[model samples]
Target chain A: MIILEYLTVIFLLIGGFFLLVGSIGLFRLPDFYMRLHAPTKASTLGIGSILVASIIFYSFKGDGVSIKEFLITLFMFLTAPITAHMLSKAALHVRQPPRPDTLNIDQLENIRDRK
Target chain B: MLENTVLAVSAAIGVSLLLNLWRFMKGPHMLDRILALDTMYINAIALIVLLGIYMGSPLYYEGALLIAMLGFVSTSAVCKFILRGDIIE
Candidate 1:
Protein backbone atom coordinates (compact mmCIF):
# COMPACT_ATOMS: atom_id res chain seq x y z
CA MET A 1 0.00 0.00 0.00
CA ILE A 2 2.87 2.36 0.79
CA ILE A 3 5.92 3.29 -1.29
CA LEU A 4 8.28 1.79 1.28
CA GLU A 5 6.49 -1.55 1.30
CA TYR A 6 6.64 -1.76 -2.50
CA LEU A 7 10.34 -1.06 -2.51
CA THR A 8 10.86 -3.64 0.22
CA VAL A 9 9.07 -6.24 -1.87
CA ILE A 10 11.24 -5.49 -4.87
CA PHE A 11 14.36 -5.83 -2.74
CA LEU A 12 13.13 -9.15 -1.38
CA LEU A 13 12.65 -10.46 -4.91
CA ILE A 14 16.17 -9.43 -5.82
CA GLY A 15 17.42 -11.29 -2.77
CA GLY A 16 15.58 -14.36 -3.92
CA PHE A 17 17.34 -14.11 -7.25
CA PHE A 18 20.67 -14.02 -5.48
CA LEU A 19 19.69 -17.08 -3.48
CA LEU A 20 18.91 -18.96 -6.68
CA VAL A 21 22.26 -17.90 -8.09
CA GLY A 22 24.00 -19.30 -5.02
CA SER A 23 22.20 -22.63 -5.34
CA ILE A 24 23.05 -22.91 -9.02
CA GLY A 25 26.64 -22.08 -8.28
CA LEU A 26 26.69 -24.72 -5.57
CA PHE A 27 25.73 -27.44 -8.02
CA ARG A 28 27.69 -26.15 -11.01
CA LEU A 29 30.99 -25.29 -9.41
CA PRO A 30 33.76 -27.77 -10.11
CA ASP A 31 35.12 -28.48 -6.64
CA PHE A 32 34.63 -28.32 -2.88
CA TYR A 33 36.59 -25.21 -1.90
CA MET A 34 35.08 -23.32 -4.80
CA ARG A 35 31.61 -24.55 -3.89
CA LEU A 36 32.29 -23.56 -0.29
CA HIS A 37 32.72 -19.95 -1.32
CA ALA A 38 29.47 -19.75 -3.28
CA PRO A 39 26.72 -20.52 -0.76
CA THR A 40 28.28 -18.88 2.28
CA LYS A 41 29.08 -15.60 0.56
CA ALA A 42 26.32 -15.29 -2.01
CA SER A 43 23.36 -16.84 -0.20
CA THR A 44 24.24 -15.03 3.00
CA LEU A 45 24.09 -11.78 1.11
CA GLY A 46 20.82 -12.83 -0.38
CA ILE A 47 19.22 -13.47 2.99
CA GLY A 48 20.66 -10.32 4.50
CA SER A 49 19.10 -8.21 1.76
CA ILE A 50 15.68 -9.74 2.27
CA LEU A 51 15.92 -9.29 6.03
CA VAL A 52 16.77 -5.65 5.47
CA ALA A 53 13.64 -5.30 3.40
CA SER A 54 11.57 -6.83 6.17
CA ILE A 55 13.09 -4.41 8.67
CA ILE A 56 12.14 -1.50 6.44
CA PHE A 57 8.62 -2.78 6.00
CA TYR A 58 8.02 -3.43 9.70
CA SER A 59 9.50 -0.11 10.73
CA PHE A 60 7.35 1.77 8.23
CA LYS A 61 4.25 -0.05 9.43
CA GLY A 62 4.85 1.61 12.83
CA ASP A 63 5.29 -1.71 14.62
CA GLY A 64 8.63 -0.37 15.77
CA VAL A 65 11.86 -1.45 14.09
CA SER A 66 12.99 -4.94 15.10
CA ILE A 67 16.62 -5.58 15.98
CA LYS A 68 16.49 -9.37 16.13
CA GLU A 69 16.57 -9.76 12.36
CA PHE A 70 19.69 -7.66 12.15
CA LEU A 71 21.30 -9.73 14.87
CA ILE A 72 20.57 -12.92 12.96
CA THR A 73 22.16 -11.44 9.86
CA LEU A 74 25.19 -10.39 11.82
CA PHE A 75 25.64 -13.86 13.31
CA MET A 76 25.23 -15.54 9.94
CA PHE A 77 27.98 -13.40 8.46
CA LEU A 78 30.22 -14.14 11.40
CA THR A 79 29.74 -17.91 11.54
CA ALA A 80 29.73 -18.83 7.84
CA PRO A 81 33.49 -18.58 7.49
CA ILE A 82 34.20 -20.23 10.82
CA THR A 83 32.12 -23.19 9.75
CA ALA A 84 33.71 -23.21 6.30
CA HIS A 85 37.18 -23.06 7.78
CA MET A 86 36.51 -25.98 10.09
CA LEU A 87 35.10 -27.99 7.20
CA SER A 88 38.10 -27.23 5.05
CA LYS A 89 40.43 -28.21 7.85
CA ALA A 90 38.60 -31.46 8.26
CA ALA A 91 38.75 -32.05 4.52
CA LEU A 92 42.49 -31.44 4.51
CA HIS A 93 43.13 -33.44 7.68
CA VAL A 94 41.36 -36.44 6.31
CA ARG A 95 43.03 -35.98 2.95
CA GLN A 96 39.63 -36.16 1.40
CA PRO A 97 40.08 -36.53 -2.32
CA PRO A 98 40.22 -33.27 -4.21
CA ARG A 99 38.48 -32.68 -7.51
CA PRO A 100 40.31 -33.72 -10.67
CA ASP A 101 41.48 -30.26 -11.55
CA THR A 102 42.40 -29.18 -8.03
CA LEU A 103 46.10 -28.68 -7.35
CA ASN A 104 47.60 -29.42 -3.97
CA ILE A 105 49.42 -26.45 -2.54
CA ASP A 106 51.41 -28.26 0.15
CA GLN A 107 52.46 -31.81 0.90
CA LEU A 108 51.24 -33.72 3.95
CA GLU A 109 54.83 -33.94 5.13
CA ASN A 110 55.14 -30.13 4.98
CA ILE A 111 51.79 -29.80 6.73
CA ARG A 112 53.03 -32.01 9.53
CA ASP A 113 56.26 -30.02 9.78
CA ARG A 114 54.40 -26.76 9.99
CA LYS A 115 52.16 -28.03 12.78
CA MET B 1 -0.22 -4.80 -2.99
CA LEU B 2 1.39 -5.84 0.26
CA GLU B 3 -0.43 -9.12 0.30
CA ASN B 4 0.58 -9.92 -3.27
CA THR B 5 4.17 -9.05 -2.54
CA VAL B 6 4.25 -11.25 0.54
CA LEU B 7 2.83 -14.13 -1.44
CA ALA B 8 5.45 -13.68 -4.14
CA VAL B 9 8.29 -13.57 -1.62
CA SER B 10 7.01 -16.72 0.06
CA ALA B 11 6.74 -18.52 -3.25
CA ALA B 12 10.26 -17.57 -4.25
CA ILE B 13 11.60 -18.77 -0.92
CA GLY B 14 9.75 -22.07 -1.23
CA VAL B 15 11.31 -22.67 -4.61
CA SER B 16 14.71 -21.84 -3.22
CA LEU B 17 14.22 -24.35 -0.40
CA LEU B 18 13.36 -27.06 -2.89
CA LEU B 19 16.56 -26.49 -4.84
CA ASN B 20 18.61 -26.63 -1.69
CA LEU B 21 16.89 -29.86 -0.71
CA TRP B 22 18.00 -31.37 -4.01
CA ARG B 23 21.57 -30.54 -3.11
CA PHE B 24 21.12 -32.10 0.32
CA MET B 25 19.83 -35.37 -1.14
CA LYS B 26 22.36 -35.72 -3.95
CA GLY B 27 25.43 -34.69 -2.08
CA PRO B 28 28.86 -35.86 -3.18
CA HIS B 29 30.16 -35.41 0.35
CA MET B 30 29.26 -34.36 3.85
CA LEU B 31 30.39 -30.80 3.41
CA ASP B 32 28.05 -30.40 0.47
CA ARG B 33 25.15 -31.47 2.61
CA ILE B 34 26.23 -29.08 5.30
CA LEU B 35 26.38 -26.27 2.81
CA ALA B 36 22.92 -27.12 1.54
CA LEU B 37 21.53 -27.17 5.06
CA ASP B 38 23.11 -23.80 5.69
CA THR B 39 21.40 -22.46 2.61
CA MET B 40 18.11 -23.84 3.79
CA TYR B 41 18.52 -22.09 7.13
CA ILE B 42 19.13 -18.77 5.39
CA ASN B 43 16.00 -19.19 3.31
CA ALA B 44 13.97 -20.15 6.35
CA ILE B 45 15.12 -17.04 8.13
CA ALA B 46 13.94 -14.93 5.23
CA LEU B 47 10.68 -16.78 5.17
CA ILE B 48 10.13 -16.13 8.85
CA VAL B 49 10.85 -12.45 8.41
CA LEU B 50 8.33 -12.23 5.63
CA LEU B 51 5.82 -14.12 7.71
CA GLY B 52 6.40 -11.65 10.48
CA ILE B 53 5.59 -8.89 8.04
CA TYR B 54 2.41 -10.69 7.05
CA MET B 55 1.30 -11.11 10.66
CA GLY B 56 2.39 -7.63 11.67
CA SER B 57 4.10 -8.74 14.85
CA PRO B 58 7.54 -9.10 16.37
CA LEU B 59 6.88 -12.63 17.61
CA TYR B 60 7.92 -14.29 14.36
CA TYR B 61 11.13 -12.30 14.36
CA GLU B 62 12.03 -13.80 17.71
CA GLY B 63 11.46 -17.27 16.31
CA ALA B 64 13.64 -16.46 13.33
CA LEU B 65 16.42 -15.28 15.59
CA LEU B 66 16.39 -18.48 17.59
CA ILE B 67 16.45 -20.58 14.45
CA ALA B 68 19.41 -18.67 13.11
CA MET B 69 21.38 -19.03 16.32
CA LEU B 70 20.66 -22.72 16.67
CA GLY B 71 21.39 -23.42 13.01
CA PHE B 72 24.74 -21.69 13.20
CA VAL B 73 25.77 -23.52 16.35
CA SER B 74 24.75 -26.89 14.95
CA THR B 75 26.59 -26.36 11.68
CA SER B 76 29.71 -25.20 13.42
CA ALA B 77 29.64 -28.18 15.77
CA VAL B 78 29.22 -30.57 12.88
CA CYS B 79 32.14 -29.01 11.12
CA LYS B 80 34.24 -29.39 14.23
CA PHE B 81 33.34 -33.04 14.51
CA ILE B 82 34.15 -33.61 10.88
CA LEU B 83 37.56 -32.04 11.28
CA ARG B 84 38.67 -33.19 14.73
CA GLY B 85 36.47 -36.21 15.39
CA ASP B 86 35.17 -34.48 18.51
CA ILE B 87 32.98 -31.45 19.05
CA ILE B 88 34.93 -30.33 22.11
CA GLU B 89 38.68 -29.79 22.02
Candidate 2:
Protein backbone atom coordinates (compact mmCIF):
# COMPACT_ATOMS: atom_id res chain seq x y z
CA MET A 1 0.00 0.00 0.00
CA ILE A 2 2.80 2.38 0.84
CA ILE A 3 4.54 1.59 -2.42
CA LEU A 4 1.35 2.18 -4.38
CA GLU A 5 0.93 5.58 -2.78
CA TYR A 6 4.50 6.48 -3.67
CA LEU A 7 3.95 5.36 -7.25
CA THR A 8 0.82 7.50 -7.52
CA VAL A 9 2.75 10.51 -6.32
CA ILE A 10 5.44 9.91 -8.90
CA PHE A 11 2.94 9.54 -11.70
CA LEU A 12 1.12 12.69 -10.68
CA LEU A 13 4.37 14.65 -10.55
CA ILE A 14 5.40 13.50 -13.99
CA GLY A 15 1.99 14.38 -15.36
CA GLY A 16 2.23 17.84 -13.88
CA PHE A 17 5.67 18.35 -15.38
CA PHE A 18 4.49 17.36 -18.86
CA LEU A 19 1.45 19.60 -18.53
CA LEU A 20 3.72 22.51 -17.73
CA VAL A 21 5.98 21.72 -20.65
CA GLY A 22 3.04 21.57 -23.02
CA SER A 23 1.78 24.94 -21.88
CA ILE A 24 5.24 26.47 -22.21
CA GLY A 25 5.56 25.03 -25.68
CA LEU A 26 2.20 26.48 -26.60
CA PHE A 27 3.34 29.91 -25.50
CA ARG A 28 6.87 29.79 -26.95
CA LEU A 29 6.67 27.82 -30.17
CA PRO A 30 6.76 29.85 -33.37
CA ASP A 31 4.11 29.44 -36.03
CA PHE A 32 0.56 28.20 -35.63
CA TYR A 33 1.18 24.67 -36.89
CA MET A 34 4.20 24.16 -34.68
CA ARG A 35 2.28 25.36 -31.64
CA LEU A 36 -0.53 22.98 -32.49
CA HIS A 37 1.80 20.02 -32.18
CA ALA A 38 2.85 20.80 -28.63
CA PRO A 39 -0.30 20.61 -26.52
CA THR A 40 -1.86 17.88 -28.62
CA LYS A 41 0.92 15.41 -27.95
CA ALA A 42 2.44 16.41 -24.64
CA SER A 43 -0.71 17.22 -22.74
CA THR A 44 -2.45 14.09 -23.95
CA LEU A 45 0.26 12.00 -22.42
CA GLY A 46 0.28 14.16 -19.34
CA ILE A 47 -3.41 13.68 -18.76
CA GLY A 48 -3.04 10.00 -19.49
CA SER A 49 -0.46 9.67 -16.74
CA ILE A 50 -2.62 11.55 -14.27
CA LEU A 51 -5.63 9.41 -15.09
CA VAL A 52 -3.65 6.25 -14.56
CA ALA A 53 -2.66 7.45 -11.11
CA SER A 54 -6.29 8.24 -10.34
CA ILE A 55 -7.34 4.75 -11.39
CA ILE A 56 -4.75 3.11 -9.22
CA PHE A 57 -5.49 5.26 -6.20
CA TYR A 58 -9.22 4.65 -6.36
CA SER A 59 -8.87 0.95 -6.94
CA PHE A 60 -6.60 0.56 -3.96
CA LYS A 61 -9.00 2.54 -1.86
CA GLY A 62 -11.62 -0.10 -2.56
CA ASP A 63 -13.64 1.94 -5.01
CA GLY A 64 -13.71 -1.17 -7.16
CA VAL A 65 -11.67 0.55 -9.86
CA SER A 66 -13.27 3.55 -11.45
CA ILE A 67 -13.31 2.75 -15.13
CA LYS A 68 -14.41 6.25 -16.03
CA GLU A 69 -10.88 7.54 -15.82
CA PHE A 70 -9.79 4.83 -18.15
CA LEU A 71 -12.60 5.74 -20.53
CA ILE A 72 -11.57 9.39 -20.49
CA THR A 73 -7.98 8.43 -21.19
CA LEU A 74 -9.02 6.26 -24.09
CA PHE A 75 -11.25 8.97 -25.43
CA MET A 76 -8.48 11.55 -25.20
CA PHE A 77 -5.99 9.33 -27.02
CA LEU A 78 -8.46 8.67 -29.80
CA THR A 79 -9.50 12.29 -30.28
CA ALA A 80 -6.39 14.37 -29.61
CA PRO A 81 -4.59 13.60 -32.86
CA ILE A 82 -7.78 14.05 -34.86
CA THR A 83 -8.40 17.38 -33.19
CA ALA A 84 -4.86 18.50 -34.00
CA HIS A 85 -5.32 17.46 -37.62
CA MET A 86 -8.55 19.39 -37.99
CA LEU A 87 -7.09 22.45 -36.30
CA SER A 88 -4.07 22.38 -38.59
CA LYS A 89 -6.29 21.98 -41.61
CA ALA A 90 -8.25 25.01 -40.47
CA ALA A 91 -5.02 26.94 -39.95
CA LEU A 92 -3.91 26.02 -43.44
CA HIS A 93 -7.27 26.98 -44.92
CA VAL A 94 -6.94 30.39 -43.33
CA ARG A 95 -3.28 30.68 -44.32
CA GLN A 96 -1.97 30.97 -40.79
CA PRO A 97 1.62 32.14 -41.14
CA PRO A 98 4.37 29.57 -40.93
CA ARG A 99 8.00 30.14 -40.00
CA PRO A 100 10.12 31.16 -42.99
CA ASP A 101 12.19 27.99 -42.83
CA THR A 102 9.13 25.76 -42.79
CA LEU A 103 9.46 22.95 -45.32
CA ASN A 104 7.37 22.64 -48.47
CA ILE A 105 6.10 26.18 -48.17
CA ASP A 106 5.33 26.25 -51.85
CA GLN A 107 3.31 23.07 -51.66
CA LEU A 108 1.15 24.48 -48.86
CA GLU A 109 0.67 27.72 -50.75
CA ASN A 110 -0.24 25.78 -53.86
CA ILE A 111 -2.85 23.83 -51.93
CA ARG A 112 -4.31 27.11 -50.68
CA ASP A 113 -4.35 28.57 -54.16
CA ARG A 114 -5.95 25.43 -55.56
CA LYS A 115 -8.72 25.79 -53.01
CA MET B 1 2.67 13.15 2.84
CA LEU B 2 0.15 12.03 0.22
CA GLU B 3 -1.89 15.17 0.73
CA ASN B 4 1.17 17.33 0.25
CA THR B 5 1.96 15.61 -3.02
CA VAL B 6 -1.52 16.23 -4.34
CA LEU B 7 -1.27 19.87 -3.35
CA ALA B 8 1.98 20.29 -5.22
CA VAL B 9 0.55 18.65 -8.30
CA SER B 10 -2.48 20.92 -8.16
CA ALA B 11 -0.29 23.99 -7.95
CA ALA B 12 1.66 22.89 -11.01
CA ILE B 13 -1.52 22.32 -12.96
CA GLY B 14 -2.80 25.72 -11.91
CA VAL B 15 0.31 27.36 -13.30
CA SER B 16 -0.20 25.48 -16.54
CA LEU B 17 -3.76 26.76 -16.71
CA LEU B 18 -2.50 30.31 -16.27
CA LEU B 19 -0.06 29.91 -19.14
CA ASN B 20 -2.77 28.53 -21.35
CA LEU B 21 -4.93 31.52 -20.50
CA TRP B 22 -2.11 33.86 -21.44
CA ARG B 23 -1.84 32.23 -24.82
CA PHE B 24 -5.57 32.35 -25.32
CA MET B 25 -5.60 36.06 -24.64
CA LYS B 26 -2.39 37.03 -26.40
CA GLY B 27 -2.82 34.93 -29.51
CA PRO B 28 -2.07 36.79 -32.72
CA HIS B 29 -4.05 34.24 -34.71
CA MET B 30 -7.43 32.56 -34.38
CA LEU B 31 -5.99 29.07 -34.40
CA ASP B 32 -3.63 29.92 -31.55
CA ARG B 33 -6.50 31.05 -29.40
CA ILE B 34 -8.49 27.96 -30.26
CA LEU B 35 -5.61 25.71 -29.46
CA ALA B 36 -5.11 27.46 -26.15
CA LEU B 37 -8.75 27.01 -25.31
CA ASP B 38 -8.50 23.33 -26.12
CA THR B 39 -5.44 22.92 -23.96
CA MET B 40 -7.05 24.87 -21.14
CA TYR B 41 -9.98 22.51 -20.88
CA ILE B 42 -7.76 19.48 -20.87
CA ASN B 43 -5.77 21.00 -18.05
CA ALA B 44 -8.96 21.78 -16.25
CA ILE B 45 -9.95 18.14 -16.52
CA ALA B 46 -6.66 17.16 -14.97
CA LEU B 47 -7.22 19.58 -12.12
CA ILE B 48 -10.66 18.22 -11.46
CA VAL B 49 -9.42 14.66 -11.37
CA LEU B 50 -6.69 15.63 -8.96
CA LEU B 51 -9.24 17.38 -6.81
CA GLY B 52 -11.26 14.20 -6.80
CA ILE B 53 -8.30 12.34 -5.47
CA TYR B 54 -7.46 15.00 -2.94
CA MET B 55 -10.93 15.07 -1.49
CA GLY B 56 -11.32 11.30 -1.55
CA SER B 57 -14.58 11.65 -3.36
CA PRO B 58 -15.70 10.14 -6.63
CA LEU B 59 -18.21 12.88 -7.35
CA TYR B 60 -15.79 15.07 -9.22
CA TYR B 61 -15.36 12.43 -11.88
CA GLU B 62 -18.73 13.26 -13.42
CA GLY B 63 -17.79 16.89 -13.75
CA ALA B 64 -14.51 15.95 -15.36
CA LEU B 65 -16.29 13.68 -17.80
CA LEU B 66 -18.73 16.39 -18.77
CA ILE B 67 -15.95 18.88 -19.34
CA ALA B 68 -14.13 16.40 -21.52
CA MET B 69 -17.16 15.82 -23.71
CA LEU B 70 -18.12 19.44 -24.04
CA GLY B 71 -14.62 20.67 -24.59
CA PHE B 72 -14.00 18.34 -27.50
CA VAL B 73 -17.31 19.13 -29.15
CA SER B 74 -16.79 22.87 -28.89
CA THR B 75 -13.27 22.61 -30.24
CA SER B 76 -14.38 20.54 -33.23
CA ALA B 77 -17.23 22.89 -33.93
CA VAL B 78 -14.97 25.92 -33.83
CA CYS B 79 -12.45 24.21 -36.09
CA LYS B 80 -15.14 23.24 -38.58
CA PHE B 81 -16.44 26.78 -38.57
CA ILE B 82 -13.00 28.06 -39.36
CA LEU B 83 -12.34 25.51 -42.06
CA ARG B 84 -15.61 25.88 -43.99
CA GLY B 85 -16.69 29.29 -42.74
CA ASP B 86 -19.96 27.58 -41.86
CA ILE B 87 -20.28 24.89 -39.27
CA ILE B 88 -23.52 23.39 -40.52
CA GLU B 89 -23.03 23.77 -44.24
Q: Per-model i-RMS in Å?
A: 1.6, 0.6
Give each model's clash number.
Answer: 0, 0
**Alpha-carbon lDDT, every model:** 0.79, 0.90
What is the C-alpha lDDT profile of model 1 across A45-68, one tens digit per residue?
A: 888888888878877878566555
* Residue A21 alpha-carbon offset, candidate 2, angstroms: 0.8
Recovered fraction of real interface contacts per model: 0.64, 0.84
Clashing pairs in 2: none
Q: DockQ for all models, in order? A: 0.67, 0.89
Q: For this target, which candidate reaches the highest DockQ against the unseen true structure?
A: 2
TM-score of each prediction: 0.88, 0.96
Model 2 Cα lDDT, one tens digit per residue, A30-76? 78888988899899999999999998889888858667799999989
lDDT of 2 by residue, B6-46 (tens): 99989998999999999999999888999999999999999
Per-residue error (Å), model 2, residue B80:
0.8
